[model samples]
Target: MRVDAFDFELPQELIALRPAVPRDAARMLHVKGGVIEDRMVLELPDLLDEHDVLVFNDTRVIPAQLEGRRGEAKVGVTLHKREGLRQWWAFVRNAKRVRDGDTVEFGGGVEATALRRGDDGAVLFEFLGDEPVELLLERAGTMPLPPYIASKRGTDERDREDYQTMFAKEDGAVAAPTASLHFTDRLVEAIDAKGIGRETLTLHVGAGTFLPVKADDTADHKMHSEWGRIDAATAERLNAAREKGGRLIAVGTTALRLIESAADEDGVIQPFEGDTDIFITPGYRFRAVGGLMTNFHLPKSTLFMLVSALMGLDTMKAAYAHAIAERYRFYSYGDSSLLIP
Candidate 1:
């Protein structure tokens, strides 16, 4: 399929620079069975059932965007994917200047070396100090804001909260599990009171999630790998829910990818801990997810492709058109959509 086949026009005004005031006040577009219905995030309890189990990616967004000096030359790095506790695959602006063996020092003397460059234009990094990257990011890095957002008031505060989901606990993601942003404790209690269960998984959403489908042919585009994990306890409970004939719903594409990656051919899911570059395009067979909650994605992005895989391409196109006409917000910190496949 051509990547251009999935392209659509979105007004710049629709790209949300900030989240809605109260999280649950954001809109929700329910797409099911080739039909679309408008709704609100607070209506989650009414939209779902007792026999449904919602899965969320609890992978926290790290303050992974860092500004540091490489021998007095200005360099920006976004630590989007982690290889080991101290190693990472980072995207560097003006990366050509910082070739192999060069070191970048962050706040304090803590530093990381440019081990090399990868095939995908990512810089291979190995931290110089013995301390883990987790601590380093927390101490020196700022929340990695999306490129589209331009901040003037203060760059620090909004990103700290906006770029993280309410349920995020595990730290790894360079980006937030967007759909989970629309949720609030009140809404969660409502869902729980309605008898819907929620489970947690981890998928360190990387900066690659924002990469455009550079190839005109969507099939030719390569998907970037992201680390994910499912604990044995969560795996057991999800399997139990399946056995009880409960519907399994993934809260975001991150959770969807983790669930799909862990499920076996028999539709049984095992605990997982690894990276996945599973590009979910149209015609791909789905094994574990029965429903998905996600934000409107960029045109020709892997996310759009994933949504196209869930609902047919035509239905998604029409639904997006409806969203555009309705003046719905788009992207991270944007409104959400629930797809019942």
Candidate 2:
């Protein structure tokens, strides 16, 4: 399908800047068997069967955004993915002036050696730090908010808690598991009380998630790789749930993608850890995931295409039209949708 097939009008005002006062108070759009229903996030448990399985991406969002100085010039660095032991693919502001081989130094004993310039003009850097990179980020890094969010003096403390999920365990993602943002401890308990099963897997959401589909033909677009893992423990539980007439419901596109990527032709999930660049488009046969809970995405983005794969192109187009008309929230800090195939 053409990349334009997923395109829709999204008003700027509809883009959410802050999370709902009570997380679970956000709206939810439920799509099942090509039928769509308007609902609330708190009402999720009522929509599914008691034995259904819900899978979540437990990758923690790191404060990967940093500010560094090139001599007297200030530059912003947002790490997309770890390249090597110390090297990372970082989006550098004012990188045009740094040139190759220039060094950028940050506050609090943080520094990086610029390795090379990428096709998108992003810089490859080898960071200098005795402690773990995660520690460095804790002290000096900023939250990697989306491009749409306007920065103030810098990333604030609220992003530290708001951008992260309650179930976040593994540390790797630059972006948050947006759908999981709507889930609170109380919400989890409510779902569990309904007898629904839950499982956790890790898929470090790379900056690739925000990358738009540049190719006119969606089929030619190449997806960036991100590290994901489904351990034997999680796999066993998930497979058992599938056998019990339970729907394997994914909490976000990241988890859904990894589940589909890790499953075989017979729909058996296996242990997986490492990079995955699996891209799903229309007509692709899904293997494992039976349903999905995900945030509304940017227009013409790979995420919107992923939604088209979960539902149909026609259904998504109609749903998005209604969302735009009704002014439902959009993007990372937005509302969510529950899609069933």
Candidate 3:
């Protein structure tokens, strides 16, 4: 399919610079059976049954955005994937000034030597110290905000808390699973009280999520791999829930992708621990996930393509049109959508 088929005009002002104050106060658009309904995030628990299970991504966002100097030239890099305890693959802002083996010195005693550049244009860098890279990032890095928001306003202390979800625990992701950001303690309690089952898996969202689809056709686009894990116990529980006639609703695209990667042709999920470059496009058959709850995505993005695949392209286009007309916020800090096909 042509990539332009997924393109839509979005007004600049529709992009959300900040998340809703109470988080749960954010609006949600419910799309089911070709119908669109306006809803609120707080009303999520009422929309599903006690037998339904909500799958969440527990990957914590690390402070991966770093600014440094390679000799006289200024360099900025966002660590996207962990290659080792001290090695990371990062997208460099000043690639022209960096060369393999060149050391970039970030402030607060943090520095790394560029090992090589990948075909996707990400540079591999090995941190030059014995201390953990997480500690080094704590002293030097800031939250890696999506470029749509960061380009409008600078990242601040508020973003440190706002950008992360309440379920954040395992540290590795450079980007937060935005769909989970709308969840709060109150909301979770409500969901639990309603008997909606909840489970979590880890998928370290990389900066590749922010990359645009420059390809003219969907087949020409390549998705960068992100590391994810689903233990045997969790897989068993998820399977059990489904066997009991419970619908498995994935909380975000990251969770949806990981679970789908773990599912067999029969739709039974298995234990998985590896990198997944699962590019979901139209005509793809969804194996395990029954539904998805995710934030609105960018035009011509892979996320949009995934959502289009979930709910037909025409249906999503109409839903998005309604969202835009209704003035719902957009992007990582935007409104939510519950897609049920």
Error of 3 at 96 (Å): 1.5
Q: After superposition, how far is residue 260 of candidate 3 from its true place, in Å?
A: 0.3
Candidate 2, pairs of clashing residues: none
- Candidate 3, superposed: residue stretches over 4 Å from native: none
Question: Hey, what RMSD does candidate 3 come out at?
Answer: 0.6
lDDT of each: 0.89, 0.87, 0.96
- What is the TM-score (0 to 1) of candidate 1? 0.96
lDDT of 1 by residue, 1-341 (tens): 98888899999889888898799999999999798999999998898889899999898988888888887798889888888768899999889779999998887666899998998888988987777778888888888877766442335777798778888898888888999999888999999999999999999899998877778886778889998999899999999998899989999999999999999997889999888999899998999889999999998888998999999999999999999999999988789999998
| Better candidate number, 1 or 2, judged by lDDT | 1
lDDT tens readout by residue for model 2, 1-341: 78887787788888898888689999998888778778999999999999899999999999998888998898988899987767888887887767778888888888888989888777898878678788888888888998887442346889899999998999889999899999998899999999999999999998878877889998789888899999999998899999988999999999999999999999999999889999998888889889999989888888888888878888988888877777789888888898987
What would the TM-scores of all predictions be? 0.96, 0.96, 0.99
- Cα miss at 292, model 1 (Å)? 0.4
Per-residue CA lDDT of model 3 for 1-341, tens digit only, reads 99999999999999999999899999999999799999999999999989999999999999999999999999999999999988999999979999999999999999999999999889999999889999999999999999999999999999999999999999999999999999999999999999999999999999999999999999999898999999999999999999999999999999999999999999999999999999999999999999999999999999999999999999999999999999999999999999999
Best by lDDT: 3
| Backbone clash numbers for all candidates listed | 1, 0, 0
Name every residue pair that clashes in candidate 1: 3-218
What is the Cα root-mean-square deviation between model 1 and the actual structure?
A: 1.6
